[model samples]
Target chain A: MRKIGKQEIEDMAVGAALLGTGGGGDPYIGKLMALQAIEEYGEVTLLEVDEVPDDALVVPSSMMGAPTVMLEKAPSGEEAISAFKQLEEYLGKKIFGTFPIEAGGVNSMLPFALAARLGLPVIDVDGMGRAFPELQMVTFYLDGISATPAIIADEKGNTALLSTIDNVWTERIARAATIQMGGSVMNAMYSMNGKNLKDSGITNILKLEEEIGKSIRLAKENNVNPIEKVLKTVGGFELFKGKVSDINRKTETGFARGVATFEGLYENKGETLQLRFQNEHLIAQTENRLLCVTPDLIAVLDAETGLPITTEGIRYGARCVVIGIPCHPKWRTEKGIATVGPKYFGYEVDYVPVEDLAKKGVTL
Target chain B: MRKIGKQEIEDMAVGAALLGTGGGGDPYIGKLMALQAIEEYGEVTLLEVDEVPDDALVVPSSMMGAPTVMLEKAPSGEEAISAFKQLEEYLGKKIFGTFPIEAGGVNSMLPFALAARLGLPVIDVDGMGRAFPELQMVTFYLDGISATPAIIADEKGNTALLSTIDNVWTERIARAATIQMGGSVMNAMYSMNGKNLKDSGITNILKLEEEIGKSIRLAKENNVNPIEKVLKTVGGFELFKGKVSDINRKTETGFARGVATFEGLYENKGETLQLRFQNEHLIAQTENRLLCVTPDLIAVLDAETGLPITTEGIRYGARCVVIGIPCHPKWRTEKGIATVGPKYFGYEVDYVPVEDLAKKGVTL
Candidate 1:
């Protein structure tokens, strides 16, 4: 295990934001809070899933709700600790370690803060390699893990422990409760051991996140194009190069969903790239071709900084570069596609892997 | 203390339905479930609040969500037991007894069923004298009690334990979960002791429910005015004797809310009464004067059968009688009126007790 210091939080947040795919909630506040917690609690240990014992209980903890609401109802730090302890007491087992449910924004950072507070390690993995709107959207759930005996808590010291028939019910019920708990809550759910974590979790997303963050930081220092650096580090490709022209966003079914349209720039002028999202960017298309979709990363980055520009942050007249990363292999399977595919999101298109979509004029 | 047998179930259902106002969900399935449990478990003991040990843990248990959905998800009779047992496990104490959270429909009967299943006594009292749409509207809340450390469970062996910032948060969050739990969930909450129960509960509503049911049954058998018998039994007054004119209902924010209008019959021929409700009847008025409002009782019964009709059960051209019963004394206080009064229900009128409304030609 290695210790995560202050500098790692920014790197974690940056990578988490990129993986956020335009929704995982803003990481700015979480980054700051994580830094504060680290400063107070010394530092958090990062433990490999392989290092954990099979009998050790590992729980993933994070904030769940609308990103917009989460911004307003900033947690009191103690919310997570309280929830974790209470959950432990209810489970009658001490949590051995913690992990983030998804590789995105605030959630990717919350477990670190919780681990620091509890003197435990943050597992070096996550349920989803990228963010999705619902609890059932997680890879762990797709891998047949139950997201139950969950707890939803607010800073007001109010906590709710939930056990549902399935992960879908967990998401539905948790979302409603979050709306009432001032629209945001801290949750500790999906208790699994090392064996299940290794089998169900997306392996080494923390290393991937750090490496991705490091590439951007290095490129920025050397005044190089972050787009190329980001592409090289994550085995990704450029989907579009453009300036955000028209953006529209709205909240639907307890989720922030909308579309961001971009007018091409440089070599791609006169072409339009349209990005549709529900919490995380799910689809990218042009007037003629469907470029990428859910379970395939659709990340919009600041043209100069390579910083992730979230769905809520998309504004008119902002330059951006869209990148696509191949989703975890598990998400590309028949069940994965069926669970996170375009059709699952109400689209008629079939699942076409990003690696196979190279016939178009975009950079690979 | 008394043992509640199958004979008392019908009377309880009848009176509970009356107290349901326009909603509390249909109690038929709940009655049947209770009867079956009683037949198997023998009978449930009804314990007085005073009989409970001062330190005994007492949790009020019931179904939560739109009453309509509950009609479909007819519980497997294990939901309440699961929730109660889960709550008991969470509290880490033996539940000395159980009580109904509200004096309406399913909630009124669920405790007895739960008690029978668990071999525990059902307290002959409730948190609310009459049903209200929201959890915060309970007399326990009005009397400065908290409805936290609660548990919600569905028939699929799923249970959610909730401890919110307040009863209002608990209701809002729990309702959202119930909607997701297929629209009806059994919950065990408000784990207070005998002292708190005596201080906050609306006492003797179970006996009252029995008396009202018996009076209507006897009156109907003797071919007398069942409406008068109902009033005489509950210390209530005739609000209106009419034929159903129009009933328009719709669900809003998780509560079954609607307006039921009646055209007067008998001696009050030409007058009309419009009842507006959200879960329970909250307002009663003609074109001008307000007849009776919330915290007070507003019961609509079939003219011939004297059977209580729920909001979901209200239909066009149904002949009915509306009776107004004086609220529990605690509900008549300033705090009571403020918490569940006409103004609280969005009416622009001052609350006048049902007895006082007699001077205004409405009820006495």
Candidate 2:
């Protein structure tokens, strides 16, 4: 186990934002929350998945709701603790450790904030190697892990401990509740033992996020293009470099649902790319080619700073590079594809690996 | 304590439906559920609020959703038991008894159905002497009793145990969840000790309902006008005797909302009356006069049989008698009026007691 200090949190937030693929909340807000918690409670211990005993219970710390709502009303930290406490009380077991449910700006950093305050270790593994919009889009769900007895607590001191028949039901009910509870709520769900985590979870996600963040930071000092360094670190293929043209977004049914259009720049002029999202980027396509789809990672990096821009942060004139990376092998399975693939998101497209799509150059 | 058999269940269902003020669920369905449970599990014990120990835990059994939805998707009985079991587990105490949260056909009978299955006593009391649409429109809320830690369970075996800052939040969150959980779910909420029930609840509500039911049934045998007998039994006034001219209703936002128009017959032949409702009837008025408004009870009964007709049961050209009864004295208080008054239901009128309105004849 290694201790995670402020520097680790800062780097992790940048990396997590990239992997978040334009969802999982804003990195600036997430970074501030983690930095503040670490400042007050000191460094938190980061434990590898194997460090936890097989029988010890572990829960992921995260939030559910439209990221737009979370921007205006950040969690007060108490909601996360309240959720954990309620889950423990209901399960009749003390949580051994906490971890990120997904790699997002807020989700990835939240574990550290909670662990620092509670004096618990932050597990290195995450259910998703990259972020997905819905709660059931996790490898744990693919492996049949139940997301209930899950607790969701609002900043207003309201909480609901849900026990659902399946993880999908958990997402449906919890999403509805999250809307009513001021459009955002902290969640302590997907509680499981270490064996399930080691077997199903994407291990060393935090390490990868830190490395991605470091690569971007070092590229600036070395006077090189940060986007190239970021793409190399994440093993991602550059889809398009473009300037934002037209973006339309609206918060509806507890989701930031909209599409962003980009005018191709530099190497790929005279082309238009469309990125559609429901909380996270679900599809990225150019005029005659399917660049990437869900179960694949699609991130937008600032043309200058190489910092990841969330869906909410994409502006009318911003210049950016879009990239796609292959998802974890778990998400490539038939069950995972059925659970979160393009068809599940209403895209009518068949499942194709990002690597395959990248190699083929263009497939409509 | 007394034993509640199938006969009592039948009578109470009729009475409870009337008290539901055209909102609570259909009596036929509620009666069938209670009678079937009684048939299998034997008689349920009925206890006066005073009979319960001061510190013993008691939760009310009810359902929250549009009655229209409950009609299409009847609960499987397992949902109610699941809700109670979850609540008991969360509280870490055996529930000493169960009661109705409101005086509605389904709300009143659900307690008996649950009590029979669990062999628990049914408390002879309820939060609302008459039904209101929203969860917080109960005396328990006025008296500062919270509705959480509450449990809501669906027929598909999903449950959510909610804890909120107040009853209103509980309603908001649970209502949203109920919509997602197939539009209806059984609820175990407003848990309190015996003392609190005695202090805040409307006592002898079941006894009153049974007496009203018996009066209606006896009227047929006595060859009497059942409306007169029913009015005398409940200390209610005849607001209008009319044939239904028009009726409109649609279930929206988890509530059956509509307006029923009546063309007066006999002594009131020249006048037309409009009754508006959200779950329960909230207002009854003529163009020239206000007859009754919530929290006073407004019930529509068959003019010939004196059996109550729910808002959903009202049909064009059906002859009916609209009656108004004074609410419990507790609901006349300032807080009670604010909680379930005419103004609360969006009617721009002051609350006048049904007795006063009847004595004055017409005040527009």
**Candidate 1: pairs in clash:** B22-B311
Model 1: DockQ vs. true structure: 0.73
* Prediction 2 global C-alpha lDDT: 0.89
List, residue by residue over B196-259, the lDDT tens digit for candidate 2. Answer: 9989999999999998898888899998988888889899999999999998988775577899
> By DockQ thresholds, what CAPRI class is model 1?
medium
Q: What CAPRI class is candidate 2?
A: high
Candidate 1 TM-score over all chains jointly = 0.92
Residues A102-159, model 1: lDDT tens digits: 9877788888777878898998999889888778888888888888888888878778
Off by over 4 Å in 1: A265-270, A359-364, B265-267, B301-321, B359-364
